[model samples]
Target: MQITKPTFYNEFSCIAGSCPDTCCAGWQIMIDQNSLKKYRHCKGAFRNRLLNDIDWKEHSFRQYQKRCAFLNEDNLCDIYSEAGKDMLCDTCRKYPRHIEEFEGLRELSLSLSCPEAARIFLSHKEKIIFRTVEKETPEETYDDFDYFLFTALMDTRDYLFSVIQDRSVPCALRRRKLLACGHDFQLCLDQNELFQWETIRTRHQNSAFGDSFQKKIFKWKDAEKSSDNLRKSIWKTIIPQMEILRSGWHDYLRDTLTPLYTSCDTEQQYQNVCLEFETFYPDWKIQEEQLLLYWIYTYFCGAIYDEQIFAKVKMAVVCTFMIHELAVGTWLLQQKQFSFPDLVSICYRFSRELEHSDQNLNKLEELLDWEEIFSLGNLLEI
Candidate 1:
């Protein structure tokens, strides 16, 4: 079997008690079967605590006021402190390090929902690189696996990453190019013309496609006017439909974004805020590129499982765009000044709310198809 991970995969270390937000809280932690058996057999001073803390009926750790029962006042795991790391469950052991499995492949990525992972990703100025390693494991097979489609998706994703990382191209142009590539690839997939994907990829990588996409972007920019009401409507309509993981998140969005959107009297003022804020943070574009690449690299390949290629790309685009919008709202809250830390906070929080919930992810994907919410033209307008 082969494993693939980002270059920064090994660089993540949990902040533990020092974490601004603890993953142990505000989320359900499922106990794997192995861990459950081990806990049942555990015989020691900590055994009672383990048995008490877990809700075996649900196969999950019990939460005390939305915080993990094991999490103490210091925001550290009491179970870990008592029984050491060996006693931790699989979910606890492999947090932030997410594993997506294929027939014989394991793709590992650090979940942006973790604040430390978010900081590591946003702090890096260089282009991200992926690494692969082979391991001796028994081969597994799946009846539904599509090797050809998977290969094509990987090649297409690699090309998209290259375009995104190209420093000479503006970030907006790179995004347009990626959307164009996905649009074209989706058309072929819709027609069951998977064999033509290579040709489509090659065409997208060519200079002519980039030039044409740039022209389209220019025309869109000329025609598009930023609207605070449009932004408000988008968030208002979409945010409520998402599965609410933490009530605080819903309240946070309401408290922070609602006022910001309402205060902007004109589209020009909103655009000016975004423009001036970018000036304060000159590397905003690079940060955005990193975010886009991260989302694409982590989730895009999973399209092989469901053949939702375009939806995956749209998810990446919409996610990065929403994060940017949240950053803008945050800047307004901070008196027109934005910080890198604030950007990191927004990315991780957004990921925590959206990425952590499968239901929410599906809802967002559904919303993408709804023309009233996020049309392709609106997504491409950026």
Candidate 2:
């Protein structure tokens, strides 16, 4: 098996008690069956504690005020504090280390939901480089794996990386091309014409209709829409659909967006504040590139199972843009004052809200297909 990860992948180390924003709180921690077995038969001191803490019916830890039952006042895992690291459940032990499994591969990444891991991502300014290391491991087979489509997705992902990492091209163009390619791939899959993938990928790689696509997209973007529309669409549309994990997240969005909604109060004021933000946070482009690549890399190939390739790509595009908009709102809230920690908070908090919940993910992807705001043209305009 081969393990592929970013250069900074191995740099993640949990800050534990030092972390102000602990992952254990605000989300239900599921206890795996294997860990449950261990807990049920546990020895003296910690056994009763585990039994009381574990919600047997739910196979998860009970939460008091949304904080995990095991989370102590210092925001440290009480299980680790008393029972030792080995006693932690699979989820707790591995987080924020996330693993995505394929036939003979395991793609491991540190979740951005952890503020520490978010710092690692935002701090690394260079273009991301993926390094694959071969590791000997047992292989498993799937009942109905779409090997051919998976191969196509793999090859297309490589091409996507090329376009995204090509700093010579503007980030906007990279994003536009990514969504365009995803749409094309999705069409081929829907038509049951997997044979056409090679041709489609090549066409996008060295676009023969470059001039035509530019003209088409340019005209589409020039349609009647303003920055205010983009802001409202991205901000207002997401909140209602999400399973708000924290009340703070609800208040956070309302408070941060007050700039665009109240302080600016006019189209020109909104646009001017946004323009000033570009100058205020010039490295946003770098962060944007990283976030797009992060989402794409993490979830793109997983479409091999469901073959909803376009939805996956749209998700990547939408999420990256959503975070960028949030960054703008946060900056505005601070009266144009932005700092490194602000970026980390925005990235991790968004990850916690969206990525942590399967329901939110499904609702988000479903909306991307039928939502007027997520239409390809609207996304480009945004």
Measured by lDDT, the strongest candidate is 2
Which window of 10 residues has the lowest lDDT sum in candidate 1?
A: 220-229
lDDT of 2 by residue, 1-382 (tens): 9898888998998888778688887788899999999999999898998899889999999999999988888888888879889989999988998888898778888888899999998788888888899998877888888788888988999888888878887788888888888888998988989899898787776762368778767876736777567758776787798898887788888777766577676677866876788788888878888888888899999998877788889888888877877888888777788988999999999999988998998888788877878777777776
Cα lDDT, model 1, residue 319: 83
Residue-level lDDT tens digits of model 1 in 1-382: 9999989899999889778888987678999999999999999998998888899999999998888999988999987898889889999999999998888899999999999999998899999999889999998999989899888988899998898898886777778777777777878888999999888777666653455757765665424535455566677767888887776787788777764667668877777777887888888889999988988998888888767777778778878878888887788778877888898889888998888788888887777655454655666654
Measured over all alpha carbons after superposition, the RMSD of each candidate to the real structure, in angstroms, is 2.1, 1.8
Error of 2 at 43 (Å): 1.5
In model 2, which runs have C-alpha deviations exceeding 4 angstroms? 208-210, 219-222, 225-227, 263-271
The lDDT, on a scale of 0 to 1, for candidate 1 is 0.82
Instruction: Give the best candidate by TM-score.
Output: 2
